[model samples]
Target: MNEAKKNSHMVGTVSELSVMLEYAKRGYTINLPTTPARYDFIAEKDGRSVKVQVKHGSTFNGERELLGFSKTPYNKRDVDVIAMFDSNDGTIYYIPTDHVEGMTSIRLRIEPYLYSVKSEKALIAEHYKKFIG
Candidate 1:
């Protein structure tokens, strides 16, 4: 791989590590970044299982925030919680599959969504609890 690709991979790895630590500090036991082997981290808390996808912030040069989701094809796997780490400030965020619906104003059409990360995570945990346990 080219140096740039290598560097980006390194950054992503670091970001995933940071994510794991954050979840751990929040009292969740977590699996490290083994994503694209699909799924980044699997966190378990209070007998709940939550799958997470960690992504770095978008590439932008201007001062304005370039907030948006990727328009590439997705399977059911990609629709789950997509977490992002702000490269500039390192704030972790959880974006659910339903968040794509918020793209009404964008050229890439998306559906309407209404739910917070806490709720989404809770639902995910409940759904996967059997397999996780």
Candidate 2:
């Protein structure tokens, strides 16, 4: 891999490990896919299984956290949830896959703009908080 790709892969690995740790702490049984799959891992709790795709959030425009999700020619993946780790603040957002099913990217700000009535960052963070734990 090229230097940039290597670094990005490293960040993704770290993010995935961090998320796995969080699930482990919550007593969820984690299972890695034996074959190539759309999802990264399967987390099970109380007999329920959730397929997760872990991603690393990076800065965009030097302020917003940007997460890109796509499968080359394919726009969507069959996963239950997307767990994004913000490397900036160490915050993890567990978003339902349906919310971003067809979108290729999403941006999150640290805080809402002073003059704006709504903030995508705040809204996304708030909506996904329920899935964090």
Candidate 3:
């Protein structure tokens, strides 16, 4: 792999590890896929299983105060949740896959803007924090 791709892979690896730790701490059992799959891993708890896709949230747009992450081409049946690792603040965010389905990219506003309409249904990073158990 090229340097950029290699570095990205490293980041993703770290993110997955961190997310696994979080899930384990919350009493969930973690399982890695034996073969190549769309999701990074499977997290099971209370007889429920969720396929998780790990993404490194390393990009931040200062002008818009938004955290940017590219949306992977995944169907609802392929992945259940997206775990985002915020490199800037070491924050882990869990977002339901359906929320970002069919999007090419995600630009999550970190904070609310005054001019922005409250009724707008934009993806806000803070809103996904509730998904973290």
Stretches of candidate 2 off by over 4 Å are 72-77, 117-123
lDDT by residue for model 2 (1-133), tens: 8999998889989899998988999999999999998778999999898888887777665564455455532224578887888877778888777777666665555454567576543334555656643
Q: What is the lDDT of residue 57 in candidate 3?
A: 70
In terms of lDDT, which candidate is strongest?
3
lDDT of 3 by residue, 19-115 (tens): 8888998898999999988888898899988898877775555633434465466467888888887776767778887888866455566666778
Misplaced by over 4 Å in model 1 are 32-36, 66-79, 101-133
Candidate 3 local Cα displacement, residue 86, angstroms:
0.3
Would you estimate the TM-scores of all the predictions?
0.62, 0.82, 0.82
Alpha-carbon lDDT, every model: 0.53, 0.72, 0.74
Q: What would the per-residue lDDT of candidate 1 be over residues 24-66, giving only the tens digit for each residue?
A: 8888998655445346778888888777766665534252232
Cα deviation of 71, candidate 1, in Å: 8.8
RMSDs, each prediction? 9.4, 2.9, 2.6
lDDT of 2 at 69: 55
Give the Cα error of residue 96 in candidate 1, in Å: 1.3
